[model samples]
Target: MSLKVAVIGCGSIATHRHLPEYAANENVEITAVCDIVGERAEEAAAKYQAKAYTDYKTLLKEESIDAVSVCLPNYLHAPVSIDALNTGAHVLCEKPMATSIEEADKMIEAAERNGKKLMIGHNQRFVASHQKAKELIESGAIGKVYSFRTAFGHGGPEGWSADGKESWFFKKDEAFIGAMGDLGVHKADLARYLLQDEFVEVGAFVETSAKENTDVDDNATLILKSAKGTIGTLAASWAYTAKEDNSTIIYGEKATLRLEDDPTYSLVAQYANGETVKYELGAIQSNDEGGQTTTHVINHFIEAIQNNTVPLIDGIEGKKSLAIILGALESVKTKRIYSLEK
Candidate 1:
């Protein structure tokens, strides 16, 4: 029997990533869709032939869902995920897992107690170029990565969010964070995945200079130190008016690897001896490019549920990535380097 699934939020992330991907996956059926805006929920439900719900609580109580994609706002991630897990459904929550680490821990605990899988939708780890970069790094192509810089920037969420400029992404209470949570968390997760290391400390300059009427930050730059003493910068910005910049550069002892830094190649490696190689792996998904047809996140979540296995980006991994952003926010508030060592 096909696993019955539901999408908790009918927002951009759900429309672009979860809904379409789930519809295409033959192993699952879209059972319901929920959104506060009745029209949005109705539209998505009609398109997918699923039930519509304005309240997630009602849907969870009624639907016999086997899995759910919690694509709600940052603040709702933890609670909705916990609720879904308790309802005997595996959950695939969007990025910036929770507004706070304490909330994230509770979500993880709920999943464990319910014996259900909880995965974070950090699609960067599944990108072809990023996966190839990890392979190269693991194969000793880039010897002893010393320093790196990764960035994720765009024109802003107004163009991407389903609600436009009035979106919850600009609200401090609803979103809890701005670019750092939206874009920066992805890079933080990517950096850890690529290096296979954990960040020990973080220092950040998170600000809201670009957008008006928003209590949250519009741009942020974080300096991070890994457990292995590797240092690097991770930048997230909504002020890049020209074009999106999702790129990473890893400086190593023998070579420097660049991922999504060039237009022609998805990944490039330059050796110290003047040899350079470029890989034309597919382009990284971008809002400008109409987003990706499949991010591989939904599929992976389904696979994990079907196989009764833990997802690669499980709740624990999600919490670790969230800690980086939370640490950066604390660093900004306290004007001191935030330590993740504890």
Candidate 2:
């Protein structure tokens, strides 16, 4: 039987990643598409031959959905996902799992109580270059990892959002965060995945300098200390006017590994012995160009449900990543190193 899937948002992420990927999967059926904007919902539903709903609560109550992708604004992630889970449907929630840890915990608890799979849409972890980098790092390609720096930046979300400049991406109440939640959370999660460690301490200087007509941050720089004593810098911004910079460089005792840093190579390694190796794995998906490719998030979520296994980026993993961004926000307010242990 095909998995009856429903997408609760008709925004950029839903249109680009979830809907297309699910539609392409033979084992999946797009049963419904919902959006507050009736036209957007109708358009997506018409394209996928699914029912259109202006309200997600109505969709949940009416449709016999086996799985759901909660792609709403940051504030709605937890409530929508918890509702879907309570309705006995697995949920694939977008990144920045929730506005708060309490909400994240509720989403996780709902999934567990209902025996459903809850996955976060952190696509960076599933990138080809990232996967290969993880394998190489585990194989001692760079020896003992010491420190690193990672960044994810673009012009802004104005062009990408369905609502353009008036989108919820810039609203403090709706997004609860700006660059950090939009881009920083991904790097935080990626760093954890790559290093196989947890961040214990975070300090940051977050600001809303670039964009006008918004109170949320458009730039942020974070310093992180991992549980294993590894330290690194993470930069997330909407102020990169030239080009997107989704890259990470890890320094180790024997060598350095760079992912998505070079224009030509996806992964590059420079050894202390003056040896250089470049792996043309694949291009990292960017907001401006070459992002049409499948993110592998929806397919992986489906497989996890079908196989009765945990998703690679499960609820707990999502919360861990969210905690980092939350910690960074707290650091900004307190002007002190935010400890994740607390």
Residue 55, model 1, lDDT: 98
lDDT of 1 by residue, 164-248 (tens): 9999999988999999999999999999999999999999998899999999999999999999999999999999999999999
lDDT of 2 by residue, 189-255 (tens): 9999999999999999998899999988999999999999999999999999889999999999888
User: How high is the lDDT of residue 26 in model 2?
Assistant: 96
Q: What is the lDDT of residue 193 in candidate 2?
A: 99
Q: Where does candidate 2 stray beyond 4 Å?
A: none
Q: By TM-score, how accurate is candidate 2?
A: 0.99
